[model samples]
Target: MISYIESFKKVSESRLNDHLIFWAKTERKGKSKTEIKEQGLNIYNVSDVESLIDTALERGELLVLDITEADRTFSLSDDGKLSLAIFLTDNFCDAYKAYSIEVDAFTEETKQLPLSKMTIMKYFYRGHSINMLKENLALANSSNTISIAYHHHLISNFYGITSLEKDACTFHFAPRLYVPPEWIGRKVTIEIEGLDEPVKLVVTSPYPNKRYYVAGVKLGRLNTANGFYPVIKPRDSFPAHKELLLRWKLDDEIRIDHHLKLNFKFTNSQGRFFSSEQQLLPDVAGMKKFTLTTTIDHSTLSERNARVIVHDIFNHYEIHEDATLVNFPMELHHSVKATSYFSKWYKSWTAEKELI
Candidate 1:
């Protein structure tokens, strides 16, 4: 029951959707699976829920987690009551566990109502019981701390583009790719519409511990103009609109680190404009969810397409002399969207099969 679905099953059994476990409530009797699942809610563990709340606080994001106690109050030990009161008083200042209890008990009450009129409650021990409850609840509600359900399918997509200078631009790749150790010294080429030739670059692992890769052309090597290089410069004509900002919602299981920088390159396409790099800042690398960021001038452009080269950024002094293309920050890929798509497709296909 430590796993997410198993825990939910333990909590809600076959009668409820996974997300309902979060609300500490359940659908009334006779609600079908279709009716319940359509609510499209997310299930979060106490840690993730707490980390998310902290991240939201850091970004000053507006999140409303409404926990309304029942009309009737239940008895607790004097110490337990005081601890719970103190936790509730400070606006749940990192009290995701308390909220978890509230929801879990509420859901239990719904199921038990048929059997008895008694109110159900979670028992917290006396004294430091609040801390113990938090620890035990976190353990009881644990899920894979870093496992993404559909990571291999790459549901995250190319979300946006940003311009760092006349010659350099950054591509926002989703759900950072795991760079292989073998790819550290590999060479790759990127082709752009306006460029006379493909941009040649090498990949290097700057942070080996993090397993992050960077691919970029070293400007120092450009001193001797070899015929093989593309002319990296601004286009002759600039579009009226030069800026863009794009955002997307992150899936529940996707976590990212905040220190990421957008992998950037130099190009001269008239359609492209100068943009700023939006770092997907998750607290611990691949441990916390991050907000996607992109910026352009006030004007926006249509989605541009390019062949993803070793799709993955760096500074001049910071760039490894042997590195080819610069490595950049990454977003969670299209796994969520792809998962949703396949689920719907599979359900429809199954229905057709049943009819046949």
Candidate 2:
């Protein structure tokens, strides 16, 4: 029996060696320094010619027929040609090595779904890895593919009932997708047989970055038993000490009368919580957007957490909470774009930076 690990190794070696053979088979006959540089910078996504050549040489003597020092050219040996031929044949006959991940999801109450699996059969040439697999897959199918899959996986692991008081559960992943601000407050449904109907969820916030993305999801309780609901949608970051605008919405079922009070609880990194209260008096509640201007005294820090609560809703409290990091000093403007000088240098030398 062929060992999968050994087979993978064989495949990787063959793939790398084929790069060298490609130069030999070209019309120019052998690989020149310029050709080698191009292959290193473009094909392999590396700039160090010495390291690239060293890696090719590690495949063994058979891959290189001759290295002409005078002209700085390379040609594949007979054995290398044979290896390249086998590699080509294998690629045609067998599937290329693919990467996949077994993702698990759950509701804030408990884990409800079995592990969901996704695979990437097509290997991405740059930054070849499992992260690349997911990134490329998302790109190919459109980001919506990942958004749906992420929700499905999260819903599958949910168990039992949950109250609005529960905090939004977060799932961290390397989605490599730019989640727009408009995606916030979007509703998603998950169907399970035992439930009365599909369970609805809303995208409260999504903190996406090159390393990982934090997805904030919570049960979309459009209709509450007490008729008191609040969903706070705050920006990921804002300016420090300045008047920050905190936006939240009241569900249609909520009655914004004199008896109801909306509470905003802000907590800084020091674990201190500040409170703000407002008695809403809307004409009638059919989903209303409210903005409250507030400032955190924590000038030393830039991140905080928030929770919104509806109090005295006929003696019941309905709440929506999220612990996603809300950064301050809006001047920093942290985002997913690769803007560092090193990133630019790397892109100019090789390919684009793999933000996974």
Compared with the true structure, all predictions reach lDDT values of: 0.27, 0.28
- lDDT (Cα, tens digit) per residue for candidate 1, span 214-251: 33333332211111112223433322221211111122
Report the C-alpha lDDT of model 2 over 1-356, residue by residue, as the tens digit. 01121222223334444543454345344667787556432343223333555654566423332233322323344444444444433543333332222212111122211211111122322234645544543354353333233223333434332321122322111111122233334332211122123333332223233222122234243211111111212323221222212222223322211111233333322111111211111111121112221211121011223333356553222322222222111111112222232243335434422443
TM-score list, all predictions: 0.20, 0.17
Candidate 1's C-alpha runs over 4 A off are 1-197, 220-236, 239-276, 279-356
TM-score of 1: 0.20
User: Model 1 scores what on Cα lDDT?
Assistant: 0.27
Model 1 lowest lDDT segment of ten: 314-323
Per-model clash counts, in order, read: 38, 7
On the 0 to 100 scale, the lDDT of residue 72 in model 1 is 16
In model 2, pairs of residues that clash are: 65-77, 111-157, 112-156, 112-157, 112-158, 113-156, 113-157
Q: What TM-score does structure 2 among the candidates reach?
A: 0.17
